[model samples]
Target: MEAAFRYREREGDLKAPYEHTEGPYPLGRWLSEQRRTFRAGQMDGERAAELEGLGIVWDTADAAFETNLAAARAYYRLHGTLAAPRGAAILDVQVGQWLTNVRRPGGLGQDPVRAERRAAALAAVDPDWNPAVLGWTVDWQRHYAYLAQLLDEGARLRAVTAGVTRHGEDIGRWLVTQRRDWARLNPEQQARLTALGVTPARVVRARQAPAKKRSTTTSGRGAAAFEAGVQALAQYLAREGGGTPGRSHVERLPDGSEHRTGVWLANQRQRRDRLDTGQLEALAGLGVPWAAS
Candidate 1:
């Protein structure tokens, strides 16, 4: 069940609609079967024990579902939709005041709805009553609240998992940036980058590298080439260094005089085999420094 939850969270969109093969099971049929099984208890000791365990598990699952359903219905009754825009507005107002009380700058500084109202008044003789406009504002607030909730949950989970102080805003921003970058890249590129454990920031920084300004001097070209070579070496080291012994490994240079050089050479070789010059240069410039040789 845990594995199923993870798979749904990670790859739900990728799954085919009809991949299950079997049609949906009827809750009524399942319940009837359960009732029969419970009535036939103690017929076989192993079967009886299994049925008893299943009953407990089923009951727990049903109770959780019921609790969640009741919460959803209550929320909808109070705030119109599950999105809970009015609730979100109240939350935003509370957050703003809370920040003011703490003497810290809060997001947007004032009520977002008031800002929208002021904009509408300036643009027209009266406030806009378009259902679409009103709906959009509500939707935006709901989205904000939904995201805040997700961030809060994620922070709690991460605090437990990583045993670190919860930094919800930083983590939320990182997640948003990562998702934006992932959305920008092709699936193949995303997969390759993910496989290599490369992050979106690294990719974005590589893309934003200053254009290689042409150098007029021969020495400048040499410096550039040397820099390029150094970068290549670093990549080689990263690819080949630090692993269990007897696997692909870097041998230390004698007297450690050119240890950096040796490491760079190793890394350069690996980078050459693994990537094109353009890719290598980009990787190198993104702070993948070559070992001192």
Candidate 2:
């Protein structure tokens, strides 16, 4: 036990090599025996619990998945997406290569249930973990995620200047191209941009008229926010099957950005009186329980 403790302390986990030793003790062999005992139902309950506390991973496959998952989560937290280039790495983990392989069919494993579970775990980390699975390119999703972040931070769409960039993507250029070629975008892309207060170039030019300038901002802001909320709710429904998200639930969008859908839902319920008929109808269409009020 002392050898096990010392090994765990130094190695961060109990998976020592079979030939490993802690001084004179055959700690690796001893740990292997413990696993055998546990599997045979001969190990004491308290002893099993103690080993678990020491991070004794019973299954090597699950352990590998968990280790890689930690690296994926860290990368997502930093870049907001798992769309890593093939050469990308987080510390010692080749997260980019791992993600690339996992995105392929049967790359997780041959076992259906385990593969589904692993895929679900990755999805929980980044809903659009595989951009191809959602009918979009990784680069497109990355750009959209940056735009979503900017909007959520209260940066108006028009204020995204020509030199603006995020993660080396010229978002300002992307925005201009998106607006100029709004018709070139698929319905989903157009809907997402519209939710963020973006419009066609022609409409934008028309709204630049002084007579409509003030009203445009005020009206666009509320409508865009509401549309974003609705889009988030719809996405939640698609991902979770049903039931509302809790207040702390942060929804990862297809573009790799997160939306505080729970908070938005709560705010909507509290301020239901301020919503227009069309907005209310939109929420009701999504089967929001409180929207009927």
lDDT string for model 2 (1-293, tens) is 88899988988878775446799998766776777687788998899999999988687576566667878888888888777765679858998878877875567899999999888989998888876656445656778888888778788877897788877768899889788767556688889889988888885444444432222212667778777777777666543334688999887766677889999999988877767666776776556767766
lDDT of 1 by residue, 121-187 (tens): 2224212211122222223233333344444455332232222222222334434444444644445
Per-residue error (Å), model 1, residue 159? 17
The pairs that clash in candidate 2 are none
Highest lDDT: give the candidate number: 2
| Model 2 weakest 10-residue run by lDDT | 209-218
Question: Which regions of candidate 2 fall more than 4 Å away from where they truly are?
Answer: 1-57, 203-293
**Global CA lDDT computed for model 1:** 0.35
Best by TM-score: 2
**Residue 206 CA displacement from its true place in model 2, Å:** 19
